[model samples]
Target: MLIDLSSNENPYAPSCKVAEAAIQGLEGMNRYVEPEELHMLRKALGEYCGVGTERILPGPGTGYLLERVLCGLAVGRELVVLNPAFLSCLDLAARLCKRIVRLQLKPPSFEVDWTLPASGPALVILESPNNPTGQCLISREALKSLLKNEDCLVLIDEAGYEYAGKTFMDLIPDHPNLALCRTLDKAFGLAGLRVSWLVCGDAFMKALHMENVCLCRPALRAALAALEEQRAVLEEVKGVIEERERLKAALSQLGLEVFPSEANYLLVRSPRPDLGLLLRKRGILIADLSGQWFSGYFRISIGRPEEHQALATAVEDILRTEEGFMD
Candidate 1:
């Protein structure tokens, strides 16, 4: 059986309500998606996020919303980005922003340099439990300091929110410059549905002019159903977190250096760089970060216990074969 764990997705099935809503929404596929339906979606999302309904803008995916946010806010400004962020942010900044100033994260720990440039950039992009490294970059105090600049617009991507269980959403009401991007894809098991949102300040809401960013009718239904059954969805997130710890311990026991992660994935440094290929041959997929800044590391999405055991067995076989070659 193929166990694909490259992308960090929730392993659990979505609630029955989500499935029911998806089937129910199909009946209206012939008609154009109405405005009121989307408005209600934003309202429900607002409640879930604990922000004003007016501040939430929904799009097909977090990347789409990220593109729009960059286009709307960072187009003519100096963009300060933390390095080794989601690859798309790096790609978009180079293309869209007038000037890009990348701040390097301190090595080993991968903690961000909280010391802002003397003249802050107009935009700053941050990711919590960042991809690849799976480390949270800033502390609450550092975040407060960053927001104090007032001129800098901070876009914090909390895509791995459920696993981390810590959020700065409460900081939104006070900081006009702060915006948080969230999606149903990661923790809610709604990747196929493609619903995401940006929670921002009044100025951003006004800046975007309340554009009706298109989310398909069926996807909207799925998103709403997912929200209604958030408790169950969160329980799944808890399960992933628990399994992540167990997997980390197991990998460590096998002599792989596993990096700390607050997200639903682990950054593992394999002794053999070709380990990903060997595993892929056995129908087990993990993210090879060797091509990225992390030259010897790969990211493993948290899977069920059986998948982890399969991976461990494969690793042992590879090590034994390699030891024979050495002898």
Candidate 2:
């Protein structure tokens, strides 16, 4: 069987309670999710996030919720984003926003300067522990400075918050212009269920209507079950982090430059761009970041130990063959 490690997903299956909850939800497939059930999910999420239920706005997925936020807040405003952000978010911004100011994050560290234009209305979108690079781009002080500007609105995607062990949700109470998009898809192993929510400040709450934010029955059940099993989620995140370090070390030993990551994947650079192709030939699929943003760089999601071993072995074989061919 082919080993797929391209998507940053939880390698382990979700807790037994989550599965049973989903199965139970299937019994009422015909009816839409009740308001009380949705409220329960939001209440559970609020408790998980340390915010009030009034601040939570549930949605089908992060991407969808992001689109809504952009459409509602981005028109006629200057859109500021990182160079290598979530691709879908970039694409959506490109289409919706008239003016986009992209802040490029250079390599080795992939750090952002956190400098915005002195004045004017702008919507700044940031992904903490940014995708592909897997590094947290902004600090609390820097974010606070931006929040001080009344005309500036900030939207942050914290999809990898569970792995990164950091968050800006606490700032929401004081900053009306700040909003956060979070999801159960990443750490909670609910990607297939498409469960996501927005922790909105007063401004966002006023702009976007909450009545339209509804989730399917199974998704609602699954997310609620997953939240209840936070202990299991913590254990899973610990395992992924350990595996990530091991995989990073293995790749570095093979002479590939692996960047430090806070998420469940590693950003690696190879001498040749065909590194993805070489591994694909061995029935191992990893994300080839060459054409998307950079060349000779790839993202490998943390997976089972055996799957990682197979990837390392394939890379070694490829390198060995290349050395022989050069001779």
Give the poorly placed runs of model 2, Cα more than 4 Å off. Answer: 89-91, 117-119, 323-327
lDDT of 1 by residue, 1-327 (tens): 789889987777687789889888888789988888999999999999988898999999988887888878777677877665554655777787778877765447776676766364578877787876777778889989888887788888888988898899999988888899899998888898888999987556766756567888889999999999889878887888889999999888887889889998998888777888888998999988766455557889998889989988887777667643323
User: Best candidate per TM-score, number?
Assistant: 2
TM-score of each: 0.93, 0.95
lDDT of 2 by residue, 1-327 (tens): 889899988778788889999999998798887889988988999999999998899898988888888888877788988876564666778887778887776788776777785256889988887888888878999999999987899989899999999999999999999999889988999989899899999898888886666688888998999998998798889988999999999999998999999988899998767888888989999999766477788999999999999999999888777653323
Worst 10 residues of 2 by lDDT: 318-327
Each candidate: what lDDT? 0.82, 0.86
Candidate no. 1 TM-score: 0.93
Error of 2 at 123 (Å): 1.4
Candidate 1 structure lDDT: 0.82
